[model samples]
Target: MHKEEIVLLHLTLFHIKRLFEQAGIANGHFKLYDSLDVQPVHIHKSKADHKKAILMLCKGITEVFKETPPDEVLRNPKMKELLEVVG
Candidate 1:
């Protein structure tokens, strides 16, 4: 991944973490493993359902951009392209 993309991903994850904390969801963690080279971003939540954890993270992401139109984020070229594959 390019430096800018990595930066954006980190920023997004940071906001997600904050949102999770605000929602009282403890131990919500995200990690990016560049070495994996596939599905590098992982969300961790102890004693939680994997699918539920992902939903919570996605909710957190939505809350983070609550003031902004979500389309604006998906419109990001790099994000758009990435989402096309992973989303």
Candidate 2:
């Protein structure tokens, strides 16, 4: 990987934040993160929302990694934790 790739990955932190929001995460308030390059992510915890949100995030990331050489979704244990928590 090159510096450009690293930069691109970091730039996509914003994209992931959007993804988190789309998955129902509030992602903290903007004003709270005014001086920071990145704000913390939050997972939506409502009874009806969490399951769907986690499923959505999982499905979306699985698709994103589909064309890659090897998928690392298996390596992300937090996803499992989220599944258990939501279930």
lDDT on C-alpha atoms for all candidate structures? 0.44, 0.40
Cα error, candidate 1, residue 69 (Å): 26
Which candidate should be chosen as best, given lDDT against the real structure? Answer: 1
Candidate 1 lDDT over 1-87, as tens digits, reads: 554454445446555454444444323233322222222133332223333344445555555467445566556565556555645
Model 2 segments more than 4 A misplaced:
1-45, 71-87
TM-score of every prediction relative to native? 0.32, 0.30
lDDT of 1: 0.44
Give Cα distance to truth, residue 79, candidate 1, Å. Answer: 24
Worst 10 residues of 1 by lDDT: 31-40
Q: After superposition, how far is residue 86 of candidate 1 from its true place, in Å?
A: 23
Off by over 4 Å in 1: 28-87
